[model samples]
Target: MAGAFEEETNLYNRIVLGSLLPEGAWEPLPHWLQGWLRNYIGGTLVYFISSFLWCFYIYYLKRNRYIPKDAIPTNKAMLLQIAVAMKAMPFYVVLPAISEYMVEQGWTKCFASIDDVGWPTYFRNLALYLTIVEFGIYWMHRELHDIKPLYKYLHATHHIYNKQNTLSPFAGLAFHPLDGIMQALPHVMALFLVRMHFRTHIALLFIEGIWTANIHDCIHGKLWPVMGAGYHTIHHTTYRHNYGHYTIWMDWMFGTLRDPEEDEAKKM
Candidate 1:
C-alpha cells in the first residue's frame, strides 16, 4: 500500500509540473472537441433542470402569494417569463472552459492521487478558478451592457424578469438564442488556452454552479440581505451599471459596480 501511494504521489507531481500524467490520467482528444462536449453537456443539463424548476417555482410563488398580479407578466410576457427561466444553462456552458484555457497557458496544472482530493487543494483551486472565471465573465458581461448592438440583439431578452425574486434568474433565458451561444465564448477561449484534466474541470463547474444560480435564483431585494439580487437587479432594471458577474471583489476592482448606499449616504 505504501509503495502504491508513493507511486501515485510521484505521478501527481509529474503531472502538475508539465510532465504527462500517467497513462491512466491522460488522454488525447483535441481540446476543442473535448470543450465542445463539455459545453454541450453543461448547457444541456442546466437548461433542463433550471427551466422546469424555475417555471414551477414561479408558478408556486404566483399561486401562493400575491405580488400584486398587476405587476405579474402579461400573457405575451408570460412566454418570455418562462423562457428566461433557462438562465442556468449559460453558466454551465461557460465555466468548465477556464480549466481548458489555464492549462494551455501553463498557469494551472492538475494533480491526481490523494493530494488533489484534499480540502486545502480544493479551496486553493476553487479560489484560483473563481478568480479566473469572474475576470473573464466580468469583462464579457460588461461589454454586453456597454456595447450597443450586442446588448440590443442578444441580451434584451433577459430584461423581461426585472420583476424581482427567485424567478429573476429566469430572465437570462429570454435572451436571444444567439445570446446563449455568445455566453460560451469565454469558455471556448478558456478551453483553447487551458489544459486541465476532467477532475479539475468538474470542480470548477461545481463552484460556478452555485454562484451563477444565486445571481438570479436568490439575488433580489437589497444588498444588505446578504447576497441579495439588488446589484444584479440594478443591472437588469437600469442596465447602466453593476456589470460584475458574481464576486463583490471583481465589481470593486473594475469600478463598474453600483453602490446605492454610498450615494444615498452622501445625500444624507
Candidate 2:
C-alpha cells in the first residue's frame, strides 16, 4: 500500500510540476507572478474555454430550434452582461489560491492522483461532494432571496434578466462580487468535507463553472432528475421559486418548487 501510494504521488508530481515548470522556468517570471501563473492561469483558461463552448452551444441550440427563443437578449444587453462577468474574474482566480492555502493548512484533503483512490471511490466522492455543495447553495440561494438587503444589493444584479431568453452563459457570472462569493461557498465547503483528488477538484470546478452557465442559458428541459435551465428560468422570472442549484429535490423538500410548464398547463 505504501509503495502504491508513493508511486501515485510521484506520478502526480511529474504530471503537475513537470508540465507546469520546466527547469529554471521561474527565473524569467517574478515570484509574485509565478504563483499567479501557476495557480490561476489554468483556471482562467478553463473559464474562457468553458464559457466559449457554452455560448456556442446556446447559439447552436437556438438556431436549430432545439430550444425556444422567446426572451433572447439584445447584443447590447449581452455585452453588458459580459462586462459584468469580467468583474468576477479576480474572485474566480482567487478561489484556487484559497484552496491551495487550505491544503497547506491541513484543512483540506487533496489526493495527488485519481489512481491513488481508484475510479469508484473517486466517483462516489464526487457525487457526495456535489450533493453537499447543492444543499449548501440551495439554502444560501434562498437566504439571498428572503433577506431583503442581500437581494437588493447583491443578488438583484444577477436577476436583471428576469425573463426567458434574456440570459446567456456569460450572464451566469454577471453577479455582484458578494453574490458570486456567496453562491460559490459550496465549492469551498466541499473541499473541507471530502478527500478529493486535485485533478478531480479542478475538474469539478470546471464543471461547476460551465454548469452554472448552462442553467442560465434558458434551454428549458429536464436533464433527468437534475433540473436544467427550465428550473432556473422560472426562478429568474418569478424570483421566488426554484432556489435549488442543481436539483429540484431541495426546492421540493422546502416547498419552493414551482414547475413552470405545469403551472402554464394549469392556466389552460
Candidate 3:
C-alpha cells in the first residue's frame, strides 16, 4: 500500500506540479510538503465544483420545488460564502495533509492494505474508526454551540448564514479557518484511536465537502440515519438542535434531535 501511495503521489507531482514548477523541483521536496500541495489543489477543486454543481441543480433547476424563490440567497450572498470558504480552504486542507504524513511515518494506526489485517479485522477496525469519528464530531459540533465563547469566536462565521434565505451550498464551507478545522479534527484524531485504511481515511475527508454541500442546500432527502439538509436547516435557524455530523443518531441519543417533520407540523 505504501508503495502504491508513493507511486501515485510521485506521478501526480510529476504530471501536475512538474508543469508549473521548475523541472525536478517537486521531486526533491519532502514527502509531507508534496502531500500538502496535492491536498490543497484537490481540495480546492472539489469544494468549488461540488458547491457549484449542487447550487446550480437545487437553486436553479429545482428552485420552485425545494425553496421559495424569494427565499433564495442572492448571487452576492453565495459569492461571499464562496469567498470566505476559499480563504479558509488552504488551512482546512492542512489537517488531512498532516494526517497523511503521520500515516506515512507509521505514527497512526493506518494500515497499508486490507491484507495486512485480513478482511475480518479490517471490517472491525473500520467500524471502530467510524464510531470514533462520529462520536467525536458530534461532541465537537455540539460544544461549538453549547460553549458561548467558542460560538462567539469560531462558529459564528458559519452561523451567519442562519436562514433559508442566507444558506446555500456555498455556505457549507464558509466557516472561519479554525472553525472548519475544529469540526474536521475528529477525522484526523480517529487515526490514533483505531486502525483505518489509509486510502479510505483520505477518501472520507474529501467526502465531507460533498456532504456539507448536501446538508446546506435546504432540500430534505429524508434518508433515515442520514443528517440531511432538512435537519441541518433547523440547526441554522434555532441554533440549539440537530448537531450531529453525518447522521442524526448522536443528536437523538443525546436529546438534541429535532425532526424536520416536527417543524412542519407547527406551521399547520
Clashing residue pairs, candidate 2? Answer: 71-165
lDDT of each: 0.51, 0.73, 0.87
The predicted structure with the larger TM-score, 1 or 2, is 2
Off by over 4 Å in 1: 1-42, 58-68, 74-78, 81-118, 160-167, 181-197, 203-214, 217-228, 259-268
In candidate 3, what are the lDDT values of residues 153-223, reduced to their tens digit? 99999999988899998898999999899999999999898888887888899999988988998888899
Q: Which wins on TM-score, candidate 2 or candidate 3?
A: 3
- Is candidate 1 or 3 superior in TM-score? 3
Task: Write model 2 residue lDDT over 145-239, tens digit each, in one string.
Answer: 99999999999999988876678777777888778778877887887788777656656666777787788878777565677888888888888
Please give the clash total of every predicted structure, in order: 15, 1, 0
User: Tens-digit lDDT track for model 1 on 140-221?
Assistant: 7777767889878777666646544423334444455566445545544553333333355554454443344446542244
TM-score of each: 0.58, 0.81, 0.93
RMSD of 3: 2.1
Best by lDDT: 3
**TM-score attained by model 1:** 0.58
Give me the overall lDDT of model 3: 0.87
